[model samples]
Target chain A: MSGSLLITFDKVWKSYGQGEATVHALAGVDLAIRSGEFVAIMGPSGSGKSTAMNIIGCLDTPTAGTYSFMGIDAGRLDRNRRAMLRNLYVGFVFQGYNLLPRTTAVENVELPLIYRGAAARERHDLAMKALAEVGLVGREHHTPAELSGGQQQRVAIARAIVTRPTLLVADEPTGNLDTARTHEIMELLTRLNTELGLTIAMVTHEADVAAYAERTIRFLDGHVASDAVNLEVAQP
Target chain B: MIWETVRLSLLSVRRNVLRSFLTLLGIVIGVAAVIAMLTIGSGTTEKVKADISKLGSNLLVVRPGRPAGPGGPGGLDQATNPLGSKELAALVAHLSGARAISPASQKQVRVIFGTESLTSGVTGTDSAYLDARDWKLVSGRPFSDSEIRSGTGVCLIGETVRQQFFGAGDPEGEIIRVNRTSCKIVGLLEPKGYTGFGQDQDNVVLMPLAAYQRRIAGNRDIDSIYVAADDRTPTTELLPRVEDILRDARRIPPDREDDFSIRDMTQIADAMASATTTMTGMLGAVAGVSLLVGGIGIMNIMLVSVTERTREIGIRLAIGAHEKHILIQFLVEATVLSLLGGIIGILIGLALAGLASLTLAIPFAPSLAVILLAVGFSALIGMVFGFFPALRGARLDPIDALRHE
Candidate 1:
């Protein structure tokens, strides 16, 4: 919480290929965020919001310039070390709620812990705590298909936070939900933000979704178009 | 982690129970085919070896023919003596490793015992001939040397002949007749099962060599001579010396071919073993084609699995799984499937081999090494076929995968 900047993007650029036919995924973007901040990236389709989130999450690296997280140069880590960093430092929630279909809710939450070789009882305890945090205490046995859309997303969010990573990235967490479920998901995410002091980065095309965060960044054609604090924020 | 993948794969199989069972059927058939082919092949080989051993170890048969005179080559029969007596005597005298040699000259004649008469062989041979044919005295003893020298009225009876005359239990010292002449049955031979050529083994009688030379047939000429070699002398070390002595005795020039033939045990064994091994290999190759088809089945199932689990893979990769994790997961799944089939096949194969052996009345020989080899080979097939689809699954773009409808 005391750090000046938890993440720094110094003119980062990303391209899919080498030639004229290359896709300019993230074109010369520059940004920084301090610890304990909840930010939303707002953009239209093909506007590079997902690319920025991907680089910030350490799932991908920039093609040029530098991106640093917690002042440890990100690009310097090898492929395996980068993976280790992602496992240790970041958690992601995708739009699809990608909770392994055959797995129960608690088992989905335990996925990251399993990868780190946590003992069974310890992982189960942690996963139970995560499920309880998302108000899924009695629903541990439910699979993704067995739960409602918002409940499934909450299980996914529980999974994202089970490892207690410093950074949480959610991409369109409520895209599949109705308005009521969307509001519930928004409230849950915001509570995780202000209450747990987690540094959050999210991408959404909805204005209401962007208004739920303390800060919002706008992207257009692979560049940050605007950065502003929310004047009329929606609280959970 | 691999075990977890296997558990999940098993769970998935349970979820699609029918499809999974169908997929495994191919592997079952493939493994069963391999095991069955190997079992039958080895069983047949054992049967052949037993039949050959029944012919007697380290003995060769010499027949009078130029291979049955195929294109009317006008080859001679047993009367012509393609294997000569002089050469056989030389084999007994000069060959470094030979034990004895005796000629066979028989004229079909009526063998009588009181009023119980039968038409049977009147073959003539020396004492060494009986040893070459693996016969032993069941009662009394073989004809004496004096009897052989005098061409006396003494003969050795086989169990069959004695049983027909004396009803088996007490035929040791009995009397029989040959060509209407009374001869004393001085000995009875031990019972033997059957010949390599399927003739009844207990249907023969032995007469003194000089007795046959003088009494059985009027002509002084002999037909084929059976030669016996010492057991310690390998055929490789004996054939050339015997051939040289026989060549000298037959009065053939250095460059001219002799009018006789000689064969040995080692060549026959080598030839039979090689032919059987080759036939097994060829049959195994045919069975292997079904294994490849089973591999294709694995590939198809794996491709379907990858396509169906794309979103799960995307989430796993997003959550920190590297490409290798996904690869190992699917590879292990496929291997488990193949190994299950292998185990089932092994049990069935052993059962099948047992049944065949019981029916054929031969020894049941199941090698654990061969079973394990088949299992390992099937697992290898799974890995080879499953790798490509697993790579495709591991490399899917998370964004596109998550977005897949």
Candidate 2:
């Protein structure tokens, strides 16, 4: 695959509270990732991996230094502009699935398109395509409550990819699943990365989950402890 | 986008049916109360106007004394400043807009016919009295001009008097005694229900003024004069002319109040209407408070909803929903709730007003402007009260919200 930088962070700092109460969530972080690469962020609780992912997703901005997405300064965008950027370019899959309650899987997948002001017929067709991509074609009508944990996560993933975003960020997406379901979810992510050439940045504490990625960035005490490529997995 | 937001709002409302209904109840009561009060108030005004019209349009009652208690002018007593034939003649001569003028003198007398006797008022007036009071003859003719001039003992009996003395017999040509004076019944007056003053209009006998002066009243004094204005003339315009004429006829100085009073029936009708309108406004204002209460209730529920749906909002935000979209969604939901309440309240109000109007024997008059205003006002209330909560939902921090349990 051709390598082109998609996201870059230069000396980014994010701190919460003020003065003596301040806590550095992400301290002096610098990193760069290419398009179509699958990277896993590994850290202990409150080690700043989630904070970095947030800045990369444009859900947040670094308090100091510059964060850029596709050569544009993402940290300088206003709230509304940032929201538009996320709608057009970023998709998120949460650990809790976060599928809308009382809504069908297909409708949940249609959320991003709705914000994009897509016509109803097109939104429906695209949502069907997205659900089918995650092996959820026949289960579009089922609600989150009516499905198993794995199926719910699949619906969440379908919602994430419905916009055909350039980047899909997953925050411990398999944290709530059992071992078999976790393997199934990781395989789905890998397949999306390989076949669609989609850029993925995932946060997880499990070593095996990080092993599935082409590269891993481990964080310790709000700083990047290690950034290395995995040579074991053969490149296409 | 708006349609989708509406759909979402409707779905959320449906999910919490009981809470939604309870919140809307306040608005329902408010709108219903306002409509019902105004409707009933208008109906009562209509009834009063109808009652006044029954007394005949553009007619003024001239009494020697001021009309007493909450209705007419004051000062002077009837016993001392009584009117006579001269005053009647002056009214006929000096007034330009008067259609008819008739002087009346009344005396309570007992009438007997065919061994049946009933005590009733004997009113002495000429042929012009019928036109002035707008009375009609049900059977037989009114007294002839010659009969009135000659003081003939022929009289017209009202329906109540006929009922009391005739006993199903034809009393048109029968003789009856008015306190020992024999009189032939020339005609029967039409039924006139009740007067606004609660007096029965059909419980009297009408006779020629000359005959009444000679026999029933035993005096040449006329108690009052009834003046009917010309068709094109308004009573308000005719009143001042009559007052001036009376003042000149009675020889009263311009600096002093008149020795008599003129009561305009239309003015009384207008006063009653305005009073009811004020009361209706007050009632509607009181009811409007409940709409505010209902609006507050909506805000309360919406705040709780925002808190409960914090994570959902965070998910939506993370998925790329604008702040304004969330704000509009909640605003529309609140408006829908209030609008539903408003529509139902209108229906209930109409039904209640109809029932009240029927029971009170008044006309049902629902104002379309008022209904539209109420609907608009309720929608406004929803927007005003729903704003803060929707703003809170819109401005939530995505990270913190998504982390909310």
Candidate 3:
């Protein structure tokens, strides 16, 4: 079965600095991701996976290539328009969870909806539903400091999905958790992918975390080393 | 959307309560300085105006010779040519615009009443002196025309002199000694309070010109002439005509500088008012520098806030907040701080002005327009000074900010 293409990168090139001090963060990247796929990108530090994630999330633009997200040229859009695209279509869950301090879990989850100019009542209801989906039903008033590592990630996930974006991009979503918490977060992502048909692109260094995705892509230096379907994960 | 930004700003301010109050202290002091200076300045101006008006409206005092140095209005020893009754009569006959004219002579003399004694300014003037100087009788009656002509032993005691000589007892008709001469007190003068120069206006004794010249001065010389203009005549029109009349009466040559000088009380009032207004403006400007310093304080704190909340800004940007939103948030926060300080400062300034007015015995003249301008200026300062910090926050690269420790 096939679905609509959500992201396309054709010969994407990105670099930092200029002249002899230049460093290529991404080199001639060509990739396509469909609307309903769960993909994991694996690479060591300095492998340029983070750069690719940033480009794909519309937080940055490619220096010399075409990056089209939802048929709009991500490389050509200005900062404000790119931010607009990110607000409407892409959600990011960072390794640090990145919850605003002194803010309640409900308010944190309501951030994206707020950026999208949602009415207060609707934003509240949607945020409540999002929090409940992450199994944090009665803990909406707790601040990030009050929540455990896994619970904070759950709140972050609620925040990411409240706007109902087409793609959820997570970079090391379980990096800071214990193994048990990591497994719980993995299970939650797997359920969200399977039950809600949410497309996900996750970056991880751990093979066990990579095993949960339907497909895996490995990077070496600034280029992809391998790309293949995960037969072990597809059957499970 | 604006309401949302304001709520966020208030939340951020509430987050660091102590820091916010410290920052507001600068603005509070600045606004307080401005309001207090302006309030007191206008109050002083009102006092000066009232004191000058008490000398009477549309009035002119012709004093012999020009003032010398800082010694005040009596003139130099070399310019000691005084007027006579013949010259006074000539001015009265020639000046048609004059409603009342009086010749004045003065001497400082020790007066004795009951067992108490004090030195008082004993001024010798005609009966029209009360009309020319706008002096009112509080009790008894003024000296009759015949009493002034014959130089009778009769005098009017001012409020301060009355208090000094008679306390609360009736001083009217009581006999009091002026140096060696015993003069009966004919009337009590209404209290005129203090002059602009802080001199007591009620510390004088008034008598008919002939009586003062005969008993106090023992001379025929008149020191000054007081003239009250008609209600229909402005001092500008009345002044030159009076000068011409004086020059003709004194027989001064056309090529020579006039021996006497005419001081228009209205002109003096206007001059005093302008000087006070100028001082108020200069003080306000000096106070405004402190406001600018206060603005710089706001800018400094806002810059620090932006740096401290770098990670928070990163989170907001990553969550798809527009740069404009972040800009508005910080700007509103700074504005709210300054406006709060401005309101508090106004209240404090009002209290200070009220206390000062009471202690100084002047009117409380708080101008609403000045208060509004100060508040508006503080807000404008917030925007002007908050801009750079807000721009720095807005223009931040999300990835760099997020990675910042």
- Number of the top candidate by DockQ? 2
lDDT of 1 by residue, B103-187 (tens): 7777667888778876666777767777775668877887677886687878787777877777836765676778766677777
On residues A1-236, what C-alpha lDDT tens digit does candidate 3 reach at each position? 15698899999989999999999988998898998899999999999999999998899999998999988888899888888888898888989999988989999999888788888899999999999999998999999999999999999999998888888999999999998899888988888887788889999999889999989998778898898998898323
Q: How well is each residue in A1-236 modelled by candidate 1, as lDDT tens digits?
A: 34469899998998887678899878999999888888999988888898898888887789998999989888666655666777787888878787888679988999888677788899899999999999988999988889998999999999999989889999988889999999999989888887888888998889998899888999999899999999989967
Per-residue lDDT tens digits for candidate 3, residues B1-405, read 778777877877888999998988889889988998899999999998898889887898888885443646545357557878877888878888788998889888999987899889899998899999889999989999999889999999999998887789899889999988999998999999888788888988988888888877888999888889989889889889878987888788899866777889999899998999899899989988998999999999999989998988887888888899789888998998888888888888888989999989888999999899989988988888899999999999888888878
Q: Write the per-residue lDDT of candidate 2 for residues A189-235, one digit (tens) a residue.
A: 99999888889999999888888899999999889999999877532
Please report how far candidate 2 places residue A230 from its true position, in Å.
Answer: 4.8
Off by over 4 Å in 3: A228-236, B66-79, B114-117, B162-177, B180-186, B253-256
Model 2 ranges with Cα > 4 A deviation: A228-236, B66-79, B84-86, B89-95, B103-130, B135-223, B244-257
The best-first sequence of candidates by lDDT reads: 3, 2, 1
Expressed as tens digits, the lDDT of each residue in B1-405 for candidate 2 is 778887888888788889888888888888898889888887877777777777766889888875466755464554558888888999888889888898888878888876888888899999999998788998999989999899999999988887887656677898888889999998998888665456777888989999999987778888888999998899989999999888899998888766787889778778877887788788878888877888888889888888999999899899898999889988898888888788888999989999998776678999999899889988998888889999999999888889999
Judged by TM-score relative to the true structure, which candidate is superior, 1 or 3?
A: 3
Q: List the residue pairs that clash in candidate 3.
A: B125-B209
Candidate 3 chain B, poorest ten consecutive residues by summed lDDT: B67-76
